[model samples]
Target: MRRMIFRRELKSNARGLVIWSLVLGGLVLMMMSVYPSFAEDAQTAEEMLNVFPEPLAKVFGMDTLNLGTYTGFYGVEVHLINTLVGSVYAALLAAGMLAKEENDHTAEFLLSKPVTRIEVTGQKLAAVLTNLFMLNAVIAAVSFACTGFADEAVELDILVWYLLATFLLHVTVASVSFLLSAVMRRTRSIVSLALGIVFLSYALHIMAGLSDRFDFLRHVSLFSFTDAAAIVENGGLDAPCAAVMVLVSLLCALGAIGYYHNKDITG
Candidate 1:
Protein backbone atom coordinates (compact mmCIF):
# COMPACT_ATOMS: atom_id res chain seq x y z
CA MET A 1 0.00 0.00 0.00
CA ARG A 2 2.83 2.39 0.79
CA ARG A 3 4.41 1.66 -2.55
CA MET A 4 1.07 2.15 -4.26
CA ILE A 5 0.60 5.50 -2.60
CA PHE A 6 4.17 6.52 -3.36
CA ARG A 7 3.74 5.66 -7.03
CA ARG A 8 0.51 7.62 -7.16
CA GLU A 9 2.16 10.68 -5.65
CA LEU A 10 5.09 10.48 -8.05
CA LYS A 11 2.71 10.31 -10.98
CA SER A 12 0.58 13.16 -9.71
CA ASN A 13 3.46 15.53 -9.06
CA ALA A 14 5.48 14.80 -12.21
CA ARG A 15 4.33 17.90 -14.11
CA GLY A 16 5.24 20.26 -11.29
CA LEU A 17 8.68 18.69 -10.88
CA VAL A 18 9.46 19.14 -14.59
CA ILE A 19 8.18 22.69 -14.69
CA TRP A 20 10.20 23.79 -11.67
CA SER A 21 13.36 22.11 -12.94
CA LEU A 22 13.09 23.92 -16.28
CA VAL A 23 12.46 27.26 -14.62
CA LEU A 24 15.48 26.94 -12.33
CA GLY A 25 17.71 25.63 -15.12
CA GLY A 26 16.74 28.45 -17.46
CA LEU A 27 17.52 31.09 -14.86
CA VAL A 28 20.90 29.49 -14.06
CA LEU A 29 21.83 29.39 -17.76
CA MET A 30 20.90 33.03 -18.23
CA MET A 31 22.93 34.12 -15.22
CA MET A 32 26.02 32.06 -16.03
CA SER A 33 26.09 33.25 -19.65
CA VAL A 34 27.15 36.70 -18.42
CA TYR A 35 30.07 35.36 -16.41
CA PRO A 36 32.62 35.77 -19.20
CA SER A 37 31.72 39.44 -19.61
CA PHE A 38 32.14 40.03 -15.88
CA ALA A 39 35.42 38.10 -15.85
CA GLU A 40 36.78 40.40 -18.57
CA ASP A 41 36.21 43.55 -16.48
CA ALA A 42 36.91 42.02 -13.09
CA GLN A 43 38.95 44.88 -11.65
CA THR A 44 36.51 47.51 -12.84
CA ALA A 45 33.58 45.59 -11.46
CA GLU A 46 35.32 45.17 -8.09
CA GLU A 47 36.10 48.89 -7.90
CA MET A 48 32.52 49.76 -8.82
CA LEU A 49 31.19 47.41 -6.17
CA ASN A 50 33.48 49.01 -3.60
CA VAL A 51 31.74 52.33 -4.13
CA PHE A 52 28.40 50.92 -3.00
CA PRO A 53 27.42 51.38 0.67
CA GLU A 54 28.96 48.65 2.78
CA PRO A 55 25.60 47.51 4.19
CA LEU A 56 23.96 47.42 0.77
CA ALA A 57 26.93 45.58 -0.65
CA LYS A 58 26.97 43.02 2.13
CA VAL A 59 23.29 42.22 1.61
CA PHE A 60 24.13 40.85 -1.86
CA GLY A 61 27.53 39.52 -0.78
CA MET A 62 29.24 42.32 -2.73
CA ASP A 63 31.58 42.76 0.24
CA THR A 64 33.27 39.58 -0.95
CA LEU A 65 32.50 40.09 -4.62
CA ASN A 66 35.42 38.85 -6.68
CA LEU A 67 34.61 38.82 -10.36
CA GLY A 68 38.15 37.55 -10.99
CA THR A 69 37.19 34.04 -9.90
CA TYR A 70 34.34 31.97 -11.27
CA THR A 71 33.33 30.65 -7.86
CA GLY A 72 33.29 34.14 -6.38
CA PHE A 73 31.16 35.51 -9.20
CA TYR A 74 28.74 32.60 -8.92
CA GLY A 75 28.56 32.93 -5.14
CA VAL A 76 27.27 36.48 -5.42
CA GLU A 77 25.20 36.39 -8.59
CA VAL A 78 23.65 32.93 -8.80
CA HIS A 79 23.71 31.23 -5.40
CA LEU A 80 21.57 33.61 -3.36
CA ILE A 81 18.86 34.01 -5.97
CA ASN A 82 18.87 30.31 -6.74
CA THR A 83 18.50 29.48 -3.05
CA LEU A 84 15.46 31.72 -2.72
CA VAL A 85 13.72 30.24 -5.74
CA GLY A 86 14.52 26.67 -4.81
CA SER A 87 13.41 27.11 -1.20
CA VAL A 88 10.10 28.62 -2.24
CA TYR A 89 9.46 25.79 -4.68
CA ALA A 90 10.30 23.23 -2.02
CA ALA A 91 8.07 24.82 0.62
CA LEU A 92 5.12 25.20 -1.74
CA LEU A 93 5.41 21.66 -3.04
CA ALA A 94 5.59 20.12 0.42
CA ALA A 95 2.83 22.27 1.84
CA GLY A 96 0.49 21.34 -0.99
CA MET A 97 1.13 17.60 -1.21
CA LEU A 98 -1.11 16.24 1.53
CA ALA A 99 -3.16 19.37 2.06
CA LYS A 100 -4.36 19.35 -1.54
CA GLU A 101 -6.41 16.25 -0.89
CA GLU A 102 -8.26 18.04 1.88
CA ASN A 103 -8.62 21.35 0.04
CA ASP A 104 -9.95 19.64 -3.06
CA HIS A 105 -12.45 17.55 -1.01
CA THR A 106 -10.77 14.29 -1.94
CA ALA A 107 -9.54 13.41 1.52
CA GLU A 108 -12.79 11.69 2.39
CA PHE A 109 -12.42 9.31 -0.51
CA LEU A 110 -8.74 8.76 0.15
CA LEU A 111 -9.33 8.00 3.79
CA SER A 112 -12.08 5.57 2.84
CA LYS A 113 -9.46 3.22 1.43
CA PRO A 114 -7.99 0.35 3.45
CA VAL A 115 -4.63 2.11 3.84
CA THR A 116 -3.62 3.57 7.18
CA ARG A 117 -2.81 7.23 7.79
CA ILE A 118 0.78 6.31 8.65
CA GLU A 119 1.18 4.69 5.28
CA VAL A 120 -0.28 7.72 3.55
CA THR A 121 2.01 10.19 5.35
CA GLY A 122 5.08 8.01 5.02
CA GLN A 123 4.57 7.42 1.31
CA LYS A 124 3.81 11.06 0.60
CA LEU A 125 6.85 12.23 2.55
CA ALA A 126 8.99 9.78 0.62
CA ALA A 127 7.59 11.15 -2.61
CA VAL A 128 8.39 14.72 -1.57
CA LEU A 129 12.00 13.80 -0.76
CA THR A 130 12.34 11.97 -4.06
CA ASN A 131 10.99 14.95 -5.97
CA LEU A 132 13.37 17.33 -4.18
CA PHE A 133 16.36 15.10 -5.00
CA MET A 134 15.30 14.92 -8.64
CA LEU A 135 14.84 18.70 -8.76
CA ASN A 136 18.29 19.34 -7.25
CA ALA A 137 19.90 16.81 -9.59
CA VAL A 138 18.60 18.64 -12.65
CA ILE A 139 19.64 22.02 -11.29
CA ALA A 140 23.11 20.73 -10.40
CA ALA A 141 23.62 19.36 -13.90
CA VAL A 142 22.51 22.63 -15.47
CA SER A 143 24.74 24.63 -13.13
CA PHE A 144 27.77 22.49 -13.98
CA ALA A 145 27.12 22.75 -17.70
CA CYS A 146 26.81 26.51 -17.38
CA THR A 147 29.97 26.69 -15.28
CA GLY A 148 31.90 24.73 -17.88
CA PHE A 149 30.78 27.16 -20.55
CA ALA A 150 31.88 30.13 -18.42
CA ASP A 151 35.28 28.84 -17.24
CA GLU A 152 38.14 26.64 -18.38
CA ALA A 153 38.62 24.93 -15.01
CA VAL A 154 36.05 24.61 -12.26
CA GLU A 155 36.51 23.89 -8.56
CA LEU A 156 34.63 20.62 -8.61
CA ASP A 157 34.89 20.02 -4.86
CA ILE A 158 33.52 23.42 -3.84
CA LEU A 159 30.69 23.16 -6.36
CA VAL A 160 29.72 19.73 -5.07
CA TRP A 161 29.72 20.93 -1.47
CA TYR A 162 27.60 23.97 -2.34
CA LEU A 163 25.06 21.75 -4.07
CA LEU A 164 24.96 19.37 -1.11
CA ALA A 165 24.43 22.16 1.39
CA THR A 166 21.75 23.68 -0.78
CA PHE A 167 20.00 20.32 -0.99
CA LEU A 168 20.05 19.95 2.77
CA LEU A 169 18.61 23.43 3.21
CA HIS A 170 15.81 22.59 0.79
CA VAL A 171 15.02 19.41 2.66
CA THR A 172 14.86 21.27 5.97
CA VAL A 173 12.43 23.84 4.61
CA ALA A 174 10.34 21.16 2.91
CA SER A 175 10.08 19.16 6.12
CA VAL A 176 8.86 22.18 8.05
CA SER A 177 6.34 23.01 5.36
CA PHE A 178 5.16 19.41 5.30
CA LEU A 179 4.50 19.64 9.02
CA LEU A 180 2.54 22.83 8.41
CA SER A 181 0.46 20.98 5.85
CA ALA A 182 -0.48 18.43 8.46
CA VAL A 183 -1.32 21.10 11.01
CA MET A 184 -3.24 23.56 8.84
CA ARG A 185 -6.77 22.80 7.75
CA ARG A 186 -6.64 24.74 4.49
CA THR A 187 -4.09 24.47 1.68
CA ARG A 188 -4.03 28.21 1.09
CA SER A 189 -3.27 28.86 4.71
CA ILE A 190 -0.50 26.27 4.70
CA VAL A 191 1.15 27.85 1.66
CA SER A 192 0.91 31.34 3.08
CA LEU A 193 2.39 30.20 6.36
CA ALA A 194 5.16 28.25 4.69
CA LEU A 195 6.17 31.13 2.38
CA GLY A 196 6.04 33.52 5.29
CA ILE A 197 8.52 31.33 7.14
CA VAL A 198 10.93 31.22 4.18
CA PHE A 199 10.72 34.97 3.58
CA LEU A 200 11.21 35.73 7.25
CA SER A 201 14.30 33.54 7.34
CA TYR A 202 15.67 35.26 4.23
CA ALA A 203 14.96 38.71 5.63
CA LEU A 204 16.63 37.75 8.87
CA HIS A 205 19.68 36.57 6.95
CA ILE A 206 19.91 39.89 5.08
CA MET A 207 19.46 41.82 8.27
CA ALA A 208 22.18 39.77 9.87
CA GLY A 209 24.45 40.75 7.01
CA LEU A 210 23.59 44.44 7.39
CA SER A 211 24.70 44.80 11.00
CA ASP A 212 26.45 43.00 13.82
CA ARG A 213 23.53 43.50 16.20
CA PHE A 214 21.41 41.15 14.09
CA ASP A 215 24.13 38.55 13.74
CA PHE A 216 22.34 36.46 16.31
CA LEU A 217 19.54 35.95 13.82
CA ARG A 218 21.89 33.95 11.69
CA HIS A 219 21.57 31.09 14.13
CA VAL A 220 17.89 30.91 13.33
CA SER A 221 18.01 31.30 9.56
CA LEU A 222 19.01 28.30 7.45
CA PHE A 223 20.32 30.73 4.81
CA SER A 224 23.16 31.71 7.10
CA PHE A 225 24.76 28.28 7.09
CA THR A 226 24.09 27.81 3.38
CA ASP A 227 25.63 31.17 2.42
CA ALA A 228 27.41 30.57 -0.86
CA ALA A 229 30.35 32.88 -0.21
CA ALA A 230 30.97 31.29 3.16
CA ILE A 231 30.53 27.82 1.73
CA VAL A 232 32.88 28.44 -1.19
CA GLU A 233 35.42 30.16 1.03
CA ASN A 234 35.40 27.43 3.67
CA GLY A 235 35.71 24.74 0.98
CA GLY A 236 32.82 22.71 2.45
CA LEU A 237 29.80 22.74 4.74
CA ASP A 238 30.15 23.43 8.43
CA ALA A 239 29.72 20.12 10.20
CA PRO A 240 27.82 21.44 13.26
CA CYS A 241 25.49 23.56 11.16
CA ALA A 242 24.79 20.73 8.74
CA ALA A 243 24.03 18.42 11.64
CA VAL A 244 21.62 20.94 13.13
CA MET A 245 19.79 21.27 9.84
CA VAL A 246 19.47 17.51 9.51
CA LEU A 247 18.13 17.25 13.04
CA VAL A 248 15.56 19.95 12.42
CA SER A 249 14.42 18.19 9.26
CA LEU A 250 14.06 14.92 11.12
CA LEU A 251 12.04 16.49 13.94
CA CYS A 252 9.70 18.18 11.52
CA ALA A 253 9.11 14.98 9.60
CA LEU A 254 8.42 13.13 12.81
CA GLY A 255 5.99 15.82 13.90
CA ALA A 256 4.16 15.59 10.60
CA ILE A 257 3.91 11.84 10.82
CA GLY A 258 2.65 11.97 14.38
CA TYR A 259 0.05 14.64 13.62
CA TYR A 260 -1.25 12.91 10.53
CA HIS A 261 -1.63 9.66 12.39
CA ASN A 262 -4.31 11.19 14.56
CA LYS A 263 -5.67 13.88 12.24
CA ASP A 264 -9.35 13.95 11.47
CA ILE A 265 -10.14 13.37 7.80
CA THR A 266 -13.38 14.88 6.53
CA GLY A 267 -14.47 16.36 3.23
Candidate 2:
Protein backbone atom coordinates (compact mmCIF):
# COMPACT_ATOMS: atom_id res chain seq x y z
CA MET A 1 0.00 0.00 0.00
CA ARG A 2 2.82 2.42 0.87
CA ARG A 3 4.62 1.59 -2.36
CA MET A 4 1.41 2.06 -4.29
CA ILE A 5 0.83 5.55 -2.88
CA PHE A 6 4.41 6.62 -3.43
CA ARG A 7 4.45 5.36 -7.03
CA ARG A 8 1.12 6.96 -7.78
CA GLU A 9 2.30 10.35 -6.60
CA LEU A 10 5.51 10.01 -8.57
CA LYS A 11 3.67 9.04 -11.73
CA SER A 12 1.32 11.98 -11.35
CA ASN A 13 4.22 14.38 -10.87
CA ALA A 14 6.46 12.97 -13.64
CA ARG A 15 5.32 15.30 -16.39
CA GLY A 16 5.79 18.41 -14.28
CA LEU A 17 9.20 17.27 -13.13
CA VAL A 18 10.40 16.73 -16.69
CA ILE A 19 9.02 20.05 -17.89
CA TRP A 20 10.65 22.00 -15.07
CA SER A 21 14.00 20.22 -15.40
CA LEU A 22 14.11 20.92 -19.12
CA VAL A 23 13.22 24.56 -18.67
CA LEU A 24 15.89 25.10 -16.04
CA GLY A 25 18.50 23.12 -17.96
CA GLY A 26 17.80 25.05 -21.14
CA LEU A 27 18.28 28.37 -19.41
CA VAL A 28 21.54 27.27 -17.82
CA LEU A 29 22.83 25.98 -21.15
CA MET A 30 22.00 29.18 -23.02
CA MET A 31 23.65 31.37 -20.38
CA MET A 32 26.82 29.27 -20.14
CA SER A 33 27.19 29.03 -23.92
CA VAL A 34 27.86 32.73 -24.27
CA TYR A 35 30.39 32.96 -21.45
CA PRO A 36 33.33 32.98 -23.83
CA SER A 37 32.10 36.06 -25.62
CA PHE A 38 31.16 37.71 -22.36
CA ALA A 39 34.61 37.06 -20.95
CA GLU A 40 36.51 38.44 -23.95
CA ASP A 41 36.25 42.08 -22.88
CA ALA A 42 35.52 41.57 -19.22
CA GLN A 43 37.01 44.93 -18.25
CA THR A 44 34.73 46.79 -20.61
CA ALA A 45 31.77 44.82 -19.34
CA GLU A 46 32.69 45.63 -15.74
CA GLU A 47 33.08 49.33 -16.52
CA MET A 48 29.73 49.38 -18.31
CA LEU A 49 28.08 47.66 -15.38
CA ASN A 50 29.70 50.10 -12.94
CA VAL A 51 28.03 53.04 -14.64
CA PHE A 52 24.78 51.70 -13.22
CA PRO A 53 23.71 52.74 -9.70
CA GLU A 54 25.35 51.16 -6.66
CA PRO A 55 22.06 49.81 -5.35
CA LEU A 56 21.45 48.05 -8.63
CA ALA A 57 24.91 46.52 -8.50
CA LYS A 58 24.29 45.23 -5.00
CA VAL A 59 20.93 43.85 -6.01
CA PHE A 60 22.52 41.81 -8.81
CA GLY A 61 25.57 40.84 -6.70
CA MET A 62 27.85 42.75 -9.06
CA ASP A 63 29.66 44.46 -6.20
CA THR A 64 31.13 41.30 -4.69
CA LEU A 65 31.94 39.26 -7.82
CA ASN A 66 34.27 40.21 -10.64
CA LEU A 67 32.88 40.06 -14.17
CA GLY A 68 36.15 38.62 -15.46
CA THR A 69 35.80 35.24 -13.76
CA TYR A 70 33.55 32.34 -14.78
CA THR A 71 31.97 31.79 -11.39
CA GLY A 72 31.40 35.49 -10.88
CA PHE A 73 29.53 35.79 -14.14
CA TYR A 74 27.59 32.63 -13.31
CA GLY A 75 26.73 34.01 -9.88
CA VAL A 76 25.15 37.08 -11.47
CA GLU A 77 23.41 35.32 -14.33
CA VAL A 78 22.66 31.60 -14.01
CA HIS A 79 22.53 31.39 -10.21
CA LEU A 80 19.69 33.90 -9.97
CA ILE A 81 17.58 31.96 -12.44
CA ASN A 82 18.31 28.66 -10.73
CA THR A 83 17.21 29.84 -7.30
CA LEU A 84 14.23 31.97 -8.39
CA VAL A 85 12.76 29.70 -11.06
CA GLY A 86 13.66 26.57 -9.15
CA SER A 87 11.90 27.85 -6.04
CA VAL A 88 8.74 28.46 -8.08
CA TYR A 89 8.87 24.90 -9.30
CA ALA A 90 9.53 23.60 -5.78
CA ALA A 91 6.67 25.61 -4.28
CA LEU A 92 4.17 24.48 -6.89
CA LEU A 93 5.21 20.85 -6.70
CA ALA A 94 4.84 20.66 -2.92
CA ALA A 95 1.78 22.88 -2.63
CA GLY A 96 -0.16 20.68 -5.04
CA MET A 97 1.13 17.29 -3.93
CA LEU A 98 -1.37 16.58 -1.18
CA ALA A 99 -4.11 19.10 -1.91
CA LYS A 100 -4.76 17.76 -5.38
CA GLU A 101 -6.02 14.52 -3.87
CA GLU A 102 -8.94 16.37 -2.37
CA ASN A 103 -9.32 18.83 -5.24
CA ASP A 104 -9.63 15.96 -7.71
CA HIS A 105 -12.15 14.23 -5.46
CA THR A 106 -9.86 11.29 -4.98
CA ALA A 107 -9.24 11.78 -1.30
CA GLU A 108 -12.24 9.73 -0.21
CA PHE A 109 -11.25 6.86 -2.41
CA LEU A 110 -7.65 7.03 -1.22
CA LEU A 111 -8.59 7.20 2.44
CA SER A 112 -11.06 4.38 2.06
CA LYS A 113 -8.19 1.99 1.60
CA PRO A 114 -6.26 0.34 4.43
CA VAL A 115 -3.79 3.22 4.48
CA THR A 116 -3.54 5.31 7.62
CA ARG A 117 -3.27 9.08 7.38
CA ILE A 118 0.26 8.82 8.70
CA GLU A 119 1.17 6.40 5.93
CA VAL A 120 -0.43 8.63 3.36
CA THR A 121 1.45 11.64 4.62
CA GLY A 122 4.73 9.76 4.78
CA GLN A 123 4.38 8.37 1.29
CA LYS A 124 3.44 11.71 -0.21
CA LEU A 125 6.31 13.48 1.52
CA ALA A 126 8.68 10.85 0.18
CA ALA A 127 7.40 11.53 -3.31
CA VAL A 128 7.97 15.25 -2.85
CA LEU A 129 11.58 14.75 -1.73
CA THR A 130 12.20 12.35 -4.59
CA ASN A 131 10.95 14.84 -7.13
CA LEU A 132 13.00 17.66 -5.63
CA PHE A 133 16.10 15.48 -5.61
CA MET A 134 15.62 14.45 -9.24
CA LEU A 135 15.07 18.04 -10.33
CA ASN A 136 18.32 19.14 -8.66
CA ALA A 137 20.16 16.16 -10.13
CA VAL A 138 19.15 17.14 -13.64
CA ILE A 139 20.08 20.76 -13.12
CA ALA A 140 23.44 19.90 -11.56
CA ALA A 141 24.34 17.63 -14.45
CA VAL A 142 23.40 20.27 -16.98
CA SER A 143 25.40 22.90 -15.08
CA PHE A 144 28.51 20.72 -14.98
CA ALA A 145 28.22 19.89 -18.68
CA CYS A 146 27.84 23.54 -19.57
CA THR A 147 30.88 24.35 -17.48
CA GLY A 148 32.85 21.74 -19.38
CA PHE A 149 31.81 23.21 -22.70
CA ALA A 150 32.85 26.64 -21.55
CA ASP A 151 36.36 25.13 -21.12
CA GLU A 152 37.13 27.09 -18.01
CA ALA A 153 39.03 25.93 -14.95
CA VAL A 154 36.27 26.92 -12.65
CA GLU A 155 36.34 26.32 -8.90
CA LEU A 156 34.61 22.99 -8.44
CA ASP A 157 34.32 23.46 -4.67
CA ILE A 158 32.40 26.67 -5.12
CA LEU A 159 30.18 25.09 -7.72
CA VAL A 160 29.49 22.18 -5.41
CA TRP A 161 28.55 24.57 -2.63
CA TYR A 162 26.30 26.51 -5.00
CA LEU A 163 24.51 23.32 -6.01
CA LEU A 164 24.14 22.30 -2.36
CA ALA A 165 22.64 25.69 -1.54
CA THR A 166 20.24 25.39 -4.45
CA PHE A 167 19.05 21.99 -3.26
CA LEU A 168 18.63 23.23 0.31
CA LEU A 169 16.73 26.26 -0.97
CA HIS A 170 14.31 24.01 -2.82
CA VAL A 171 13.84 21.73 0.16
CA THR A 172 13.25 24.63 2.54
CA VAL A 173 10.66 26.30 0.31
CA ALA A 174 8.94 23.03 -0.59
CA SER A 175 8.64 21.99 3.04
CA VAL A 176 6.81 25.21 3.88
CA SER A 177 4.54 24.78 0.88
CA PHE A 178 3.90 21.22 1.93
CA LEU A 179 2.62 22.48 5.27
CA LEU A 180 0.26 24.86 3.46
CA SER A 181 -1.00 22.03 1.30
CA ALA A 182 -2.19 20.24 4.41
CA VAL A 183 -4.33 23.23 5.40
CA MET A 184 -5.77 24.26 2.05
CA ARG A 185 -8.76 22.51 0.53
CA ARG A 186 -8.47 23.74 -3.04
CA THR A 187 -5.56 23.75 -5.44
CA ARG A 188 -6.15 27.33 -6.60
CA SER A 189 -5.07 29.23 -3.51
CA ILE A 190 -2.43 26.68 -2.75
CA VAL A 191 -0.64 27.62 -5.95
CA SER A 192 -1.13 31.35 -5.60
CA LEU A 193 0.07 31.35 -2.02
CA ALA A 194 3.04 29.15 -2.85
CA LEU A 195 4.20 31.43 -5.65
CA GLY A 196 3.57 34.38 -3.40
CA ILE A 197 6.06 33.04 -0.88
CA VAL A 198 8.71 32.61 -3.56
CA PHE A 199 8.29 36.09 -5.03
CA LEU A 200 7.95 37.75 -1.65
CA SER A 201 11.13 36.12 -0.42
CA TYR A 202 12.86 37.38 -3.56
CA ALA A 203 11.56 40.89 -2.95
CA LEU A 204 12.91 40.79 0.57
CA HIS A 205 16.29 39.72 -0.77
CA ILE A 206 16.38 42.65 -3.17
CA MET A 207 15.32 45.03 -0.42
CA ALA A 208 18.11 43.78 1.80
CA GLY A 209 20.64 44.53 -0.91
CA LEU A 210 19.21 47.95 -1.77
CA SER A 211 19.76 49.52 1.63
CA ASP A 212 21.50 49.15 4.98
CA ARG A 213 18.27 49.53 6.91
CA PHE A 214 16.93 46.33 5.38
CA ASP A 215 20.11 44.33 5.95
CA PHE A 216 18.44 42.25 8.63
CA LEU A 217 15.96 41.03 6.03
CA ARG A 218 18.74 38.88 4.64
CA HIS A 219 18.28 36.49 7.55
CA VAL A 220 14.67 36.08 6.54
CA SER A 221 15.22 35.41 2.85
CA LEU A 222 15.93 31.88 1.62
CA PHE A 223 17.56 33.43 -1.43
CA SER A 224 20.18 34.87 0.87
CA PHE A 225 21.22 31.35 1.83
CA THR A 226 21.86 30.63 -1.83
CA ASP A 227 23.55 33.90 -2.70
CA ALA A 228 26.16 32.90 -5.31
CA ALA A 229 28.61 35.69 -4.53
CA ALA A 230 28.60 34.83 -0.85
CA ILE A 231 28.98 31.15 -1.65
CA VAL A 232 31.95 31.88 -3.91
CA GLU A 233 33.52 34.19 -1.39
CA ASN A 234 33.17 31.87 1.61
CA GLY A 235 33.76 28.64 -0.34
CA GLY A 236 30.57 27.27 1.27
CA LEU A 237 27.25 28.12 2.87
CA ASP A 238 26.94 30.19 5.99
CA ALA A 239 26.60 27.85 8.95
CA PRO A 240 23.87 29.86 10.62
CA CYS A 241 21.79 30.27 7.46
CA ALA A 242 22.19 26.62 6.51
CA ALA A 243 21.13 25.60 10.00
CA VAL A 244 18.01 27.72 9.66
CA MET A 245 17.20 26.05 6.38
CA VAL A 246 17.49 22.61 7.94
CA LEU A 247 15.54 23.59 11.03
CA VAL A 248 12.75 25.29 9.09
CA SER A 249 12.37 22.44 6.63
CA LEU A 250 12.17 19.89 9.43
CA LEU A 251 9.63 21.83 11.46
CA CYS A 252 7.41 22.54 8.48
CA ALA A 253 7.49 18.95 7.29
CA LEU A 254 6.65 17.65 10.75
CA GLY A 255 3.91 20.24 11.03
CA ALA A 256 2.49 19.09 7.73
CA ILE A 257 2.43 15.53 8.97
CA GLY A 258 0.66 16.51 12.18
CA TYR A 259 -1.88 18.77 10.52
CA TYR A 260 -2.51 16.35 7.68
CA HIS A 261 -3.26 13.54 10.08
CA ASN A 262 -6.17 15.54 11.49
CA LYS A 263 -7.24 17.31 8.30
CA ASP A 264 -10.86 16.72 7.33
CA ILE A 265 -10.79 15.94 3.65
CA THR A 266 -13.90 17.16 1.83
CA GLY A 267 -13.92 14.48 -0.80
lDDT: which candidate is best?
Answer: 2
lDDT of 2 by residue, 139-215 (tens): 89988887764555887787788888999999999999999999888888999999999999999999999999999
Q: What are the clashing pairs of model 1?
A: none
lDDT of 1 by residue, 42-118 (tens): 88878887888998787777776476677777778888767889999899889987888888998888878898888
lDDT of 1: 0.86
* Candidate 2 wrong stretches, greater than 4 Å: none
Q: How accurate locally, in lDDT, is each candidate?
A: 0.86, 0.89
Candidate 2: residue 186 Cα off by (Å)? 1.7
